[model samples]
Target chain A: TQLLEQSPQFLSIQEGENLTVYCNSSSVFSSLQWYRQEPGEGPVLLVTVVTGGEVKKLKRLTFQFGDARKDSSLHITAAQTGDTGLYLCAGERAGGFKTIFGAGTRLFVKA
Target chain B: SAVISQKPSRDICQRGTSLTIQCQVDSQVTMMFWYRQQPGQSLTLIATANQGSEATYESGFVIDKFPISRPNLTFSTLTVSNMSPEDSSIYLCSVHGGQGNTGELFFGEGSRLTVL
Candidate 1:
């Protein structure tokens, strides 16, 4: 079974602080996606990185895929309270349309 | 990405009773998936609902415990049979992974179930 492990399962920071979360896996993937989910809501797509060593930015958020396609990272700049949510990293496997998700890093940005 | 609308946005069911959640897509989707996220846990794929075939369940998930129906394209249903308190969780439906992509799952608002 393929698994993606996310670190810093929980995080709390003050407004304006910057933070980074990571997702690592031993298996290779064709694509990787980042999602942010609020309480009682399904995850919303943040960004998708396809190429190895690729980077994609969405406003204040930046996503990077590992050169080997076995890892990824997400960085948030000027983090605000509105950025508080569960950040999930998912990998799309080869020939498999299913998206496997990481355990998620819960972010709580205080005002 | 596809827009998926799931029904029974929130439900409070009694133990031993069952709840059936519905998911509908705006267009014919090439893929449909069901996922469950227990409290504080990651999203876990419960099954893959195809347009014409029986749903394919992931490991640790069985048809009897979580029966699913996909009568045609753009529609699917998942039934939590003989529910229990531990079965309470958020259920989400997704489809149309991505454009010329291997994976991209657009999700619904999610059905929140609370079994008491």
Candidate 2:
């Protein structure tokens, strides 16, 4: 079975602080996606990285797919109270329709 | 992107009872997915519902405990039978964004179930 391990299960930071969450796995994936979920809501897609070493930015968030497609990272710059949520990374294996998700990183940004 | 609506946004059920969550998509989709999530945790795919066919459940999940029905392209239902305290979790329904194999998924707000 393929599993994605996420680091820093919980994080609490003050406003304007920078934080990085990492997702690692031993198996390669065809594509990786990052999602943010707020309380009482389902996850929303932040970005999708399909190529190795790909980097995509969405405002204050930067997502990176590793060169081997076995890992990914999300970096938040100057995080604010609005950035507090659960961040999840999901990967799709080659030739498979199943998407495996990481345990998730709960980020709390205080204003 | 697809819009999904789930019924019974939140419910409180007693042990040994059953609850069925309904999902409706605005647009027709070939496949709809059911996921289970504990509070503050990531999603776990329970099964994949396809119209006119039996649902495909993931490992560790059985059809007997969670029966799924996809009568058409735009609707599906998942029933949690003989519920227990451990069955308390949020159930989400989702569909692909029509971007092919590696496309993103759009999910409903989810049905939060609390079993006593």
Candidate 3:
């Protein structure tokens, strides 16, 4: 079974601070996606990175996929209180039939 | 964008009782997914529901404990049988539908179950 590991499982930061979260794995994935979820709700799609070394920006969030397709990262610039949520990374295998998810990083941006 | 809705947003049931959660999507989707999230944990795929086909469950899950049904392309149901305290968790329904069928997955609000 393939697994994705997320680092810094818990993060607490003040508003306007910058934070970065990492997702790594030994298995190579054909595509990777990032999602943010709040309490009592389902995850919301942030972005999907399909190419190695590719970067996608969504407002203040910047996401990058590793060149080897074994890792990914999400960087938030000038974080706001609204950014406080659980961030998850999911990867799709080459066959597109299976997918694995990371443990997720919980960000607490204080106002 | 596909809007997925799940019924019984929150419920408290006895340990031996069973609960069935319903998922409805705004649009017809080819793939419907069910996931479970333990308290303070990540999401785990329970099974994949395909229209007119038996659900494919993951390694740790079984058809007896979690039976899934997909009556059509836009609707599915999951039933948790003989529930225990360990079965208490948030059940979420998701779909693989987006612009041009991208890899992105959309999720429902989720059903929170408490087995006491």
Off by over 4 Å in 3: B99-101
TM-score of each: 0.96, 0.97, 0.97
Q: Tell me the tens digit of each residue's lDDT in model 1 across A29-62.
A: 8899889999978898888898999998889998
B1-116: candidate 2 lDDT, tens digit per residue: 88999998999999999999999999999999999998777899999999999999998999999999999999999999999999999999999877563658889999999999
Candidate 2, DockQ score (0 to 1):
0.80
Q: Which residue pairs in candidate 1 collide?
A: B97-B104
Q: Write one digit per residue (lDDT tens) for candidate 1, span B7-104.
A: 99999999999899999998887568999999888899999998788889999999999999998888999999999999999999988565675577
Q: Predicted candidate 2: interface RMSD?
A: 1.0
**Candidates' interface RMSDs, in order?**
1.1, 1.0, 1.1
Fnat, one value per model: 0.79, 0.74, 0.82
Task: Give a tens-digit lDDT track for model 3, residues A1-111.
Answer: 338989889999999999999999988889999999999999999899999999999999999999999999999999999999999999887666666789999999999
Candidate RMSDs in Å, in order, are 1.3, 1.2, 1.2
DockQ of each: 0.80, 0.80, 0.81
Query: Model 3: how many Å of interface RMSD?
Result: 1.1
TM-score of 2: 0.97
> Candidate 3 docking: what grade?
high
Q: Relative to the true structure, how large is the alpha-carbon lDDT of every model?
A: 0.90, 0.93, 0.92
